[model samples]
Target chain A: GDSVTQTEGLVTLTKGLPVMLNCTYQTTYSPFLFWYVQHLNEAPKLLLKSSTDNKRTEHQGFYATLHKSSSSFHLQKSSVQLSDSALYFCALSPSNMGYKLTFGTGTSLLVDP
Target chain B: GALVYQYPRRTICKSGTSMRMECQAVGFQATSVAWYRQSPQKTFELIALSTVNSAIKYEQNFTQEKFPISHPNLSFSSMTVLNAYLEDRGLYLCGARRTGVQDTQYFGPGTRLLVL
Candidate 1:
């Protein structure tokens, strides 16, 4: 079985500040990690995903590096925007079972002016 | 660009009733469609995985009798929730993927189910 852990339940920060959302996963097989953002009343959108170890994947100003050694793929943004506030979920999909995604509890990010 | 559309953005049904939701894929072939439920204040849970020409696989705690899924073609899928109750209320999302393309799955807006 595969599992993803997002340690932070809620992260509040001011605009223009750097932000990091912790994400760690556990799996016996090769892992493919993903970061999904879901705004209020909207479907979850893919923000970043990666399968290659140590390779950083970036999309929409968000970046994450898959570190297989530590089983982490923390999402980071250089400058947080007011619109960046949303619920972020870290998911893990074993390479062998790519269609089944195990999601974390999700972290609600609140950005203030 | 690939897109997934879900029918009936929101619905309300009485306890013990049943409702069926549909998932459609556009601009690509959805060889695999996965159904997920996001309970209130909770993360998403995988209910079942439907692949073309293959049997549907239901996850633990979810049975085909309770959630019957049909993937008759590559572009469409439907699932019916039988005997819905208060605990079954949630946002049901369908994630469709083209198996040969990549592992990334695009999700639909989801059908919000409310049980009274």
Candidate 2:
């Protein structure tokens, strides 16, 4: 079975500071990893995704690099803004599983001004 | 670009009642749709996968009789939660994928279910 793990349950940061949300996963074969952000009362939107190993993908000022050797795809941002606060999820598309996703217990990011 | 829409953004049902939620995909072909439940504790659990012209696949602990899904076309789907209870209360999200590509699943504003 495939699974995703986010080490932090909540991460609070002051505006303009750096942001890092840890994500790790376990799978039997090659996997597709994704980061989804959900604002209060909103649907989850994709932030970034990667399947290739050791390649960094960026979107909306956020970036993540998939490290297959370490089985990690940690989301990072150089500078955080107040609007960046949201519930972030790390998910895995299981190998050979058709369109099914396994998600982690989300990390609530709080950006304080 | 692709977009997913869910009907009845929020619904409240009495215990043991049944409720059905709809999912529609626009701007792209939704070859497959996956249903997930985001519990109050906020864990996204895959309930089932419905593909056009194929049998719906439900995950462990989820059954067709309990969460029956229908994918009659490429762009529309619906799922009925039978005999709803407090434990079934959560945000039910429908994620549709274009061209059966599992890499990206565009999610819709979920149907929030409240069982009482």
Per-candidate iRMSD: 1.8, 2.2
Q: B1-116 in candidate 2: lDDT tens per residue? A: 78899998999999999999999999999999999998898699999999899999999999999999999999999999999999999999999988856578899999999999
For candidate 1, what is the TM-score?
Answer: 0.96
Q: Please list all clashing residue pairs in model 2, or write none if there are none.
A: none
DockQ (model 1, Cα): 0.63
Q: Show where candidate 2 strays beyond 4 Å.
A: A96-98, B100-102
**lDDT (tens digit, per residue) of candidate 1 on B1-88:** 8889999899999999999999999999998999999899788999999999998999999999999999999999999999999999
Clashing pairs in 1: none
> How big is the positional error of residue A25 in model 1, measured in Å on the Cα after superposition?
0.9
Query: Model 2 chain B, TM?
Result: 0.96
* Candidate 1 per-residue lDDT over residues A1-113, each given as its tens digit: 77899999999999999999999999999898989999987778889989999988899999999999999999999999999999999999998345789999999999999
